[model samples]
Target: MLWETPFGHYYGDNRENNGNYFANDISNFYEELIKKCNFRIGEGFYVNILKNYLSILKEDSEYLYYFKIKPLISILECEQYLKLSPNKEVRDLYLECLNECSSLYNKYMNVAR
Candidate 1:
């Protein structure tokens, strides 16, 4: 599967040796679970990949610059706005994503402005 981000695009194969990995399928499953929580989400489940994607951009760094975090901040802003939607379920789902995003930032990608 291919994962694209603001930084770059990554190409990876699920077929490693003799085993066939179903990572994207598993991701789709999570995506569905999270999507069920939000009625208005456009991109489906986006909860699991941001950190891993960013880590690909900076393997050795424990922190990233504020400028380099525009993508994350944009997602955070969207989550905040989504939390205000009339749909209670979407708001709750956005809240869940927001909380998890915050935790990820605090743990792995401390922004240095």
Candidate 2:
């Protein structure tokens, strides 16, 4: 649902303004997706939503920190993140986030280096 949020789109190319809004949307979507996963909404269903969420992050250079940069950095600092649910499918979704986020994260990092 968070393809290109109203808030983020309003901010447009203004990274400074868009950052916080994008960050909020990213954080909220992740948590909401976890809730959906816990509800046992089916792996395939949530996977599409999660993929869309990640796609939003990957494509938006202005708010890369929220999706690609900050999350990977936190994982690096903490070594690992929490499991959203004990269910296998839920865990799979979580891993998918990590995988997709990491791909974008690596891409950004490589360009920076």
Candidate 3:
């Protein structure tokens, strides 16, 4: 259900009145994801939150429609960036995250069509 709040109108889960508020803007939504992570990337926009962000995109069709840029383009940029990481550990993590991101992106694109 939809409800109006001081922040704005939000889509709330009908199961619970105290359900989470999903922000309409990408920046606000990104902030909420960051709050749940232990490690944060100082540089790079979507790369830092690739997996989770794409997962959110798959779940919210409305968000994908209004997003400024195609998420896969950003994901491709991140893939190029992570590909150059000299460190084996970072590269390893990148590979894992990239796989999940690719899957999520596919799901999102299919739904979008």
Cα lDDT listed for each candidate: 0.49, 0.57, 0.51
| TM-score for predicted model 2 compared with the true structure | 0.35
- The model with the greatest lDDT is 2
Please tell me which predicted candidate would have the highest TM-score against the true structure.
Answer: 2
lDDT of 3 by residue, 1-113 (tens): 45655545555566453444443454564555454332334444435465555454455444344353356546545445454454444455556656555555666677788
In TM-score terms, candidate 3 sits at 0.32
In Å, residue 78's CA in model 3 sits off its true spot by 4.2
> What is candidate 1's local distance difference test score?
0.49
Per-residue lDDT tens digits for candidate 2, residues 4-99, read 674345445666666787888878867865675456445457556655655655555543464535754464334233255546654665566677
Clashing pairs in 3: none
lDDT of 3: 0.51
Please provide, for model 1 over 52-88, each residue's C-alpha lDDT reduced to its tens digit, 9 standing for 90 to 100.
4344334333444434565765766654445445556
Superposed by TM-score, candidate 3 places the C-alpha of residue 16 at a distance from the truth, in angstroms, of 74
Q: What's the ranking of the predictions by TM-score, best on top?
A: 2, 1, 3
Which residue pairs clash within candidate 1?
Answer: none
Report residue 20 deviation for candidate 2 (angstroms). Answer: 43
**Which parts of model 1 are misplaced by more than 4 Å?**
1-73, 109-113
Task: Write down the RMSD of all candidates, one decimal each.
Answer: 14.6, 14.3, 14.7
Question: In angstroms, what RMSD does candidate 3 have relative to the true structure?
Answer: 14.7
